[model samples]
Target: MNILLKMLLSMSIASVILIPLVWFLKKVFGQFLTKRKSYYAWGVVFFFLIVPFAFFFVQKNTEFLWGTPSEFAGLTSMVIGQNGIEVERSTQAVIFQFIMDYVWVLWLMVGLIMLVYRIASYRNFKKFVISGAHYIEEPDELDILAEAMETIGLNKPVEVMINPLISSPVFFGFRREIIVLPSTSFSKKELYHIFLHELVHCKSKDMYVVFLAQIFTCIYWFNPLMYWMIRQLERDREYACDESVLSYLPARDALSYGDTLLHSIVKSGTYKESHAAVSLHENAKMLKERLEAIASYKKGKKGYISFLLLLILLTLIGILLNFYEAKAFIYEKKQGIEIKKEDTSKKTEFRAIDLQNANQDVTIRKGKTESFDLTTYDENSKAELVVKNGILMYKNANPNTQSAIIITIDADKVYDSLSIQTTGTQIKISDIHTKTMRIKGGVIIAHFNQIKADTINVTTGSANVHLTDSEVNKGMKFNGNNALIHFEKSSFNNLEMTSFLSAKLNDLNVQGGLSINSGGQLDARNITTDTLKLIAGNSGNMKFQNTFVKKSSEFQDNESMLLQFDGVLNGQTRMSIGPSQTKFVIRDKMQKYAIDAQSSQADTFILNQSIVNYPFTQNLSAPNNITLTNDSPFNNNFNLSFEE
Candidate 1:
C-alpha cells in the first residue's frame, strides 16, 4: 500500500469516527458550548482531512533513508543462457505492477477534476455577482456600513455592493471583502442588522474557512461523510456569526435581528450559496434552528477555554490513533497471513541436508541436536522434515507461505553438503561446518556469520548477500541478476562473481584470486587479492578503493565504462578502457611502475598531475608494468597520481 493512500484511508476512518462524536456531543450538551466554540469544534474534523498531506510530504522526504525499497523497484532480472542475457518477468507480477502504477494516477486525476470544478463554479459565481452589482452610493447606506465596520473593529476597507439579482446578503472575496445585498425594501433597523451580520463574517474571516472546507470536500470526495461534515460546518459558521452580531447589538434588538433573519429566509430563493462565500441566509430548513438559537442565546462565562483544552487533547489522541491505524492497515494489506510457531527436536543422525521451496525467513545454526522450529500461517503450510538415506530433507508444500522457519543441525559432525533453494526468503546461517554449500533463490537475503565452509555457491535472480566473520576454505562463487554482495572481515581462497545488472563488493580478503564479470556497475572496496580480473560488458562504471592486486591484474570494458582505481599494484596491471575516463591513484608512492599507453584516436594522459601526450611510454624497462589501451572514436582521458 502507498503511504499516502494509507494515510488517506486512516484519515477517512478517523473522520467517520469523529463526525458522529461531534454530532452526539452537540445533541447532548448543546447549551454548554457557545455557538463560536461549536463552530471551532469542526476545525478538529478538518485537521484529519488535511494532515495526511503533511504525512505525505514527510514520507517523500525521508523515504530514501527509512523506507524499504520494493523488491521490483528498479530491478530487471536477466538470466544468462546460450542466447545471452534475457529479461525475465512473471506474467502475474507484470499485471500487478501495471495495476499498481495506474491506480494512484486515477485517484489523482479524479481529485483534481473535483477541485477544478468546484473552483470554477465559485469563480463563475463571483463573476456573475460582480457583473450585476454596483457600489452602494446612498448616504444613509454608507453611514450604516461605516458604523457596522466600526462596531466590528475592522480597519480594512470593505466594498458594499447592491446586486439586484441576489435576495440575501452575501459576504464574498478573500483578500478584498465584498458584501453584496439585494435592492429589497426593509426597515432601518433591519438594514443595520443585515450590515452588521456580513461585516462580522468579514471580520471573523469566515470566507477563508469556507474555502478550506471546499478544498477538503474535493480531496475527500469519495467519503460521503465529508459532505455532511461540510454542511454541518456551514451551519455552525452562520450560527457563530449570528451570535457575534447579537453581541454588538443591544438585548432589545435581538428580536429585531431575529426578524431580519426571518425576512432574509423569506427572500432566500433568489440566490444559492457557494462554497467560496458566506451568506446571511442559508435556507428555510436551517432558519428555524437559527431563530431558536438566537432567541435562547446568552452571554456566558469563558467556558470555551476548557472546551478548547479538551479539543486539543482529543485532537492529539486522534492523530496518534490515525498513525497507528495506518501502519496496521499497511501491515495487514502487505502481509495477509497469520503465523503460528511449532518447535520440534529430533535425534536423527544425518550427514547432509537439503531445504527447498521456502517463502519465509529461515535460520540455520549449530545446536546440540537436530531441531526444527517453524513459524507458518497454519498446519497446512508446515514443511515436511525427515531424514532418509543419510540426508535430512526439508520441504514446504505451500511454496507461497510466508513466515519463519529455523533449523538447528547437530554440531558434532560436519555435513558433507547443505543446499537450500527458496523463492522469497531471508536465510541466516551461523557456526556450522559443511564441505560444500549451495543456495539458490529468486529473491534471497542471506547473512552468513562465523561459518566454516569448504566451498559456497550462491545463485539468485535478485539477492542481498552478506558474509561477515566467515571463512570459505576452498572458493566462493556467486551468479545473480541483481545483487548487493558484501563480505566484511571474511576470507576466501578464491572469489568469482557474475552479475547481470550490478554488484557491490566490500571488505573482502582473497588468498588466490578475484574475478568479476558484470553487465552493469561494479564497486569493490577494501579488497586484498593475489590476482584480480574485471570485465564489464555494458556502460557500467567500475570503481575500486583500497584494493591491493598482488600479482597480475586485467580490466576490460566492452562499452564506455568509467574506470576509477585508488589502490596499490604489486606487479603488472593492464586496462582496456574504450572512450571513457580513467583515474588511478597509487596508494604506495615508493612502488615504481612503467606506463605503456596506446590509443586509436586522440587521448590525454596525465602522469603525476602533468599532462602527457600519448602514445606515451615511460621507463619501459621497469619491473612493474602498467599498460593502458583505448580503441574508441572519441578522445580518451587518463589520470595517474600518487596518493596525497
Candidate 2:
C-alpha cells in the first residue's frame, strides 16, 4: 500500500510540475519554434509521468542508514510521519497482502472495464469505416494525394476513401495509413489544402500519437488530469500538422490554404466528432487558434537547443523527485545484544512465547532472550519459574487451590520480548523497554511509568489498562470485551483497537492513525488522532471532547451520547451519525467551516459570530436544507461558531 501510494503521489507531483512548465513554454516560445516542435514538448510531460513508476521498480533497498529519495521522500514523510514508525515484518506483510488482494484488484477491474468499452467503440468505428466507405477512383484526386505524399518523401500506399458520415478529413491507421474524406464537393484549391494536411498527418505519424493517447486514456481513466493531457496532446498534434502543411505552401497562398481549412471546418458543423481517427478540423476555437498561428507565421530558425535543454532539465528533475531509499531489512527481525545472568551454573535459554496454564502473579519485563533473572518471593506457595527458548514463565506448582504468588522481574538486565497471562493476577510492571509486549487472557492490572516498545498487543476478557509517560513506536492493538483503557501523557503512532459488549477510552492519544471497532459505549476525552475510522454496533453511545483531528475522519452509523469539539480540526470530515439524537457543540469560534446538512426534519444552527452567517438559520422550525459556509479568505482565523 505504501509503495503503491508513493508511486501514484510521485506521478501526480511530477505532472503538476511539468504540465505548467510545458504550457508556459508553449505560450512564450510558440512563435520562436514551429508547431511541430511544440507538439513534441508534450513527450517530456509524458516521460515525467512514467519516471516515478520506473524508479519504483528498479530502486534497491538499503540498510537503516539508507536515506529516502529526495523528491518523493518529502511526500512520503508528509503522510507517514518523520520518525518512520517501524512495524514488524509480519505486520507489513499482512498490510501488503490485504492491499494486493483488495485494492489492487479493484483498480485493475475498473481499468479493464474502461478498456473494454473503448475497444468496443473503436471496433464499431472500424465496422463503419469498412462498411460505409468506398475507395476514391478519381484519377485527378488520387494523383493530387500521391503528389502530396511524394513531396513529403512518403512511399507507403494509402487508400483515399470518401464517406458522408464524416464531418472532416480523417487520417486513420499507422501501419496502413488511410485518408477518409467527407462526401462534399471540393474546389481544386480546397483539394490541394486538404490533401496536403492529411498527408502531413501521415508523414508525421500523428496516428501513432493518437493510438498511444487512447491506450493511456483507457488505463488512467480514473485520473482527470490524464484525460486533460491527452486532449492537449491531440490539439498540439493538429497544430503541428497544420504548421507542416503551411510550411510547404507559398507565402502568397497561405491565406488561400487558411480559407480552405475554415470552409471545410464550417461545413463539418464546426467540430470533428470522430474518435477513431485524427480529423483535419477539430473545433471552431481550435481552428481559430491555428488560423491565427498561420496568419502570423514568420519562418524563423527553429530553436532546437532551447527545446532540448528544457526537455533534459525536466527529465532530470522528474528522476530526482520520484526516487527514494528503500529499507533492505524490511522482511527481517530486529536483533539485540545479549546479557549474562547471575546464575552461572546454567545459562538462561532463549524461547518464543509460553502459552501454558500459569496460576501465579507474574511481573514480566524485557530482557535478553539468551539470559534472564527469575526471582521468587513467598516460598511457602511453591512458585516455579520455567525458562524455555526465550520466554521466562512463572507458574504456581499447585493449581487445585488458591495460592498467592509474587514474582519480581528484572528485564533491564537483558533484551527480550515479554508475554504475561495470568488468572486473577495483580501484575505491576514499570520502566520496561522491549521490542514487543503481548498480554492475553489475563485479569491484569499493569502500570507503566516509562515503557517503550515497538508494539503492544493486549487481548483480555476484561481488564483495566493504564499507562503514563510511555510511547509505542509502531502501534498498539487492544482486543478485549468490556475493557477500560486509559492513557495519560502517552501516545502510539498507530492504533487498531477492537472491543465488544462495552469499552471505554480515557485520554487516549494516537500520533498517527486509529481504527476502532466496538459494540459498546465509548467515553473518549482529550483524544488526538491524525486520522480516525470508527465502526460501532447498534447499542452504545460515543462521547468525545478536546479532540484534535487532521486529514480526515469517517464514522459509520455512530450513535453518540454527546459530541463536541474543543480543539482544532484541519481537514475534511464525514459523519454518519445514526439515530442517536446527536448534537454538536463547537466552542472554537475561529475555525472556518463548510457544513452540509440533510434531514427531513429541521435542524438548529446557532451562529454567534458576525463574520459567519447561514441564511437558512431562520427556517429551523420547518423542514429545510441548509448549507453553511464560512467564506473567509484568510487561513489563520476561522469565521464560524456553533453553540447551544
Give all TM-scores, in the order shown. Answer: 0.47, 0.45
Best by TM-score: 1
Count of backbone collisions within predicted model 1? 0
Give lDDT tens digits, candidate 1, residues 187-286: 6788889989998888888888988888877777778998898888889899999999988998888988999988866554476756788888777789
In candidate 1, which residue pairs clash? none
Least accurate 10 contiguous residues by lDDT in model 2: 70-79
- lDDT score, candidate 2: 0.63
* Segments of candidate 2 deviating more than 4 angstroms: 1-9, 53-101, 269-274, 323-644
lDDT of 1: 0.78
Residue 562's lDDT within candidate 2 is: 34
lDDT for every model? 0.78, 0.63
